[model samples]
Target: MLHHWYISHHHLYIPPSMTIHHHHHLLLLLILFLLTPPLSTSQNDTVSCPLNFDLLRRLVGSNRPSIDSSTVCRYAQQALRLVESDHLRRTSSFVPPPNTAESCWTAYQAVSDYFYPNFDLRRNCGFQTNWITVPGCMNITNRQQFENKISNSSLNAVVSACNQSLTGSSCSSCTVALSNLQASYLNGESVGNLTDCRAYPFIYAAAFINQLGPTDRGTAVCLFSLSINFSKSNNKHKTVIIVIVITVVIVIVLFGSAIGFWYSKRLKKLNRKRRKKAEINTVSALDSYTGSTTLIRYTIEDIKEATRNFSRDNIIGRGGYGNVYRGVLPDDTEVALKRFKNCSAAGDGSFAHEVEVIASVRHVNLVALRGYCTATTPFEGYQRIIVTDLVKNGSLHDHLFGSESLRANLSWPVRRKIALGMARGLAYLHYGVQPGIIHRDIKASNILIDENFEAKVADFGLAKFAPEGATHVSTRVAGTMGYVAPEYALYGQLTERSDVYSFGVVLLELLSGKKALLSLGDGQPVLLADWAWSMVRNNTPLEVIDGGMAECGPPEIMEKYVLVAVLSSHPQLYARPTMDQVLKMLDMDFPVPTIPERPMPLVAGIEDIERSVSSTGSAQLSTPRGYQAYTFEMDVRLASKEEEEGKC
Candidate 1:
């Protein structure tokens, strides 16, 4: 022993060379010293911090050799809570002291060493490759898994784990570990396998202890380490499996694309055959109606020449159904050609027959239908065309609220004349026709003006015939939203009064120089009819007149006209006047009627109106009075004006 000895300043001596057996003995002594817990001042004095054997036993039982990321996170959270609770209980305060992190780290290290004698924090826990790296692991499913694990754990196990992690010199390391574990859990970071317990073995143990409670601590430790080692060894196998899966996916995509292309081609051929059959049927129907003289059937070539192959420059109007283009015939007669898009030949042929009957309807205020053409082309497929007299001044909507040039030309007198003409035209459709035609859509856009500014009612596509003895037709509700009559819109009850209601809305628009639907910066949009009614009910009918129309007519005359508009647009089907009656009131042929108090049922908000209008194809309301009322209100102001002018 004295062969070589070294002495330190502290007076401790060590032999420079020792026997192998002696060296082994010295290592055992050092090991025993490190394993012993720190001593208290008195031999009988109990250590203030004791290991929570019950918690460790529970954690060991619950833990699986291999666990998912969610299970790891749940265990981590439980360990942190236990540590926090124990800290508060011992300190008698909720707030953690400054040395809390150090204490937590120390406790965590001690536990790790106790569980796995050869545990390496950096090599096992710090290596990123050892953990699962799935993207979006913090999503709903992961959170749900965490909740389930916690819910299934024993309460005692959770409390014991927390207490153990918060006590003794080991507390500093445990506290630090707990904080790290909590952060990782919240962010949905993955914990490695059992052997590589990810810096917090106590947390991992606490989570699964209930499930693995029967296993001895030594066996649990051995199993955890083995599982981690096995996982590490399978890295190459995982890479191979991933490559195979990617290759299979590429094959699937290629096969799907090829099959889709073949199916698409077959569909196109079938569609072509169907289109050809439809075209033949349409031609046969047209030949049967060739005797009708009202509509002149033009050749496809003639239409093409007239419309300049449907040039974009010639387009005057565009709508959901089709486009209207200006065309010049070989005879120098200019016409408006409406080319319907996405129409089948059978549909076009039926429409042409209807056009033949509508063409027979001749009136000064109605746009004349010149001819029609139905054909198939190589590039454009089936074509449906309706030719009418070209009106240079465009639609009434264009002049009333269109371009500046058009508005400038529509003087107050011109506007009044246009309004009167529109009334007379609608009157002709509702009363003059043999089987009365109800123009389904009667907005300003349908009323066209010629070069002379005369109103020509057009667009009879949506019109329906009012047969003899039928007060109302039960057809599909179709029209512009704001201008649709509540009776017809809500119930699809198409009566002559429906047209009357629409005309009333238009009349209000004329009086106010506003759109049929007016937005006043409020939540709900105001219908022109509703706004006019409100003004009249408030006894401020003069306020409803357009400012630009101040010089259009006298206040008394304008007020009377506004009253006529409101009375005609009354929401009740029975309350609205007939189109003929509307014309008479506007022309001063009949006295303006006293607008009755709007029926309580009609004073609904905009949402109610929309709901009623959209509830088409449902049960309809009963028919109201089919006859028009003759009773009128004698306005004192109008009577005075008449007295002075000597025209009453």
Candidate 2:
């Protein structure tokens, strides 16, 4: 016919004009046929979860029988991992789709093959594909809710408790807590078929391990295996267990005794070496100073008898350095024995060498060293001991601002005398010695009061001696907060002036009956120096004196003492007077100078503080450095630029 065209299985016919276009279409079809993948390969690539044959083999152990319902969950977990890891493992160049899934048949087949010979694990053990992410009891509404609930539970704490210790026992509290967590939140009670309920613990462990550490995974997996404990009750086995236990105990006793004996001998040898080293350092340091006081070496037994085995009742005072205990010496002398808490070998050397510092100095106003003892005991380690005459009154801090019963003992005259005595003691350390000793920790607590209420400067653990002709020794800053001088606190440039600055703070404390560091209304710390100076600069000097002592002394005398304290604690290092100069100021041998108007402290971190200061005019923040209190000052930098310029 009419220009006949035919399309058949083997042949196609077209009119001569359209024959060229037909050939092009046939060529395009041939290219696609060559590029297309085989059916099997495409099927393999499409399966979201591919269970490696080797991984399945490892999951079902060779040692065990084909699993029960509880055991089959372990196999289910291995199959579930492929899905979870895919979520983390990328499929394309970098970014991937947020979620992925697979045919339930894929998971079912691999998990079935895991127990290879017995492939019908579901019928035998009642396992299912949906049990992958959570236990059967927790009926989750959505994917997000499931994730949120598990995350909120934070099973780490409970799981950590169940971690087996060296003794091969786990925390009972852990078991109880975990049980409660399951009951309350996880709905751990069997609510479904018995087979699914049996599968819950294993699935629960699998979900929890994904969130926990690797070390905890082993413990978590065994939770159910260990929990399935069966108690065998038989009279015959009870006798056998008791006999086995006795034999094991006997063997362990013999082995342990040998180890303990060897350890004790080794410890004794090490302690002897430390004791000898400490002695040499003590002798060498003491020999250099040719003072009249002798460091009498006492025995450890004598010390123990003196302090009644270091009884708690005998504890007279305690500080950051050590505890001071009251003891009666064999010679019928009452002594205060300072037992340092530092039992380390390095600490032994320090306290040993320092025994000569305050011990060698003989002054009525200074706590003289009666004697010192260094001994080693099997139990108490190396004992570095120092003996001194006991001061009946605890400390200047005790009477002036200590407990109420102690505070009553201090009248205005007594406070004045104590202040004078403290100045004398510090003066002796600074000027009386050939090489001046800087009492770096010169605070009210360090100044002990005797029966006569005389203040004796004590606790020379942080003392440093000025080298000949050196103005300031650049050393580590060691002192209390609210008392450290500007140069020493910021730059660690220490000198005799650092001690004077501390003394000034103590003097201020004595006058105001306020602590050197005062906590304000909002728990902000205001230094006594700042508060006292503010009153004196405002012509209300009497306000700085203790309200109780307001009428005890002439207002003029009190005002003079207040002015001297302010002068001695001046922020600038050079502006601070030496201890000798301070002594004369207290004695009125030198007149009180004109009061200086203190500007905002131009010390370290003041700029950051100025920037951080809010509308409230005070801010609590960390210190750039550390001292006693652990926090820096806000009152120190409260004044603004305009105010500082106006006051200065």
Shift of residue 561 alpha carbon in model 1, Å: 1.8
Question: Candidate 2 local accuracy as lDDT?
Answer: 0.60
Task: Give each model a TM-score.
Answer: 0.51, 0.52
Error of 1 at 178 (Å): 85
Using lDDT as the measure, which candidate wins?
Answer: 2
Writing each residue's lDDT as its tens digit, candidate 1 over 251-348 gives 99999998998899998888778867867776666555555655678888998899898889999997655789999999999999877777764355
TM-score of 2: 0.52
lDDT for every model? 0.58, 0.60
Q: Point out the worst 10-residue segment of candidate 2 by lDDT.
A: 91-100
Q: Alpha-carbon error at 181 in model 2, in Å?
A: 78
Model 1, poorest ten-residue lDDT window?
623-632
Candidate 1: list runs displaced more than 4 Å.
Answer: 1-290, 601-648
lDDT of 2 by residue, 459-529 (tens): 88778877989756877556666777755664567878888888989999998899988876868666788
Q: What is the RMSD, in Å, between candidate 1 and the native fold over all Cα?
A: 28.9
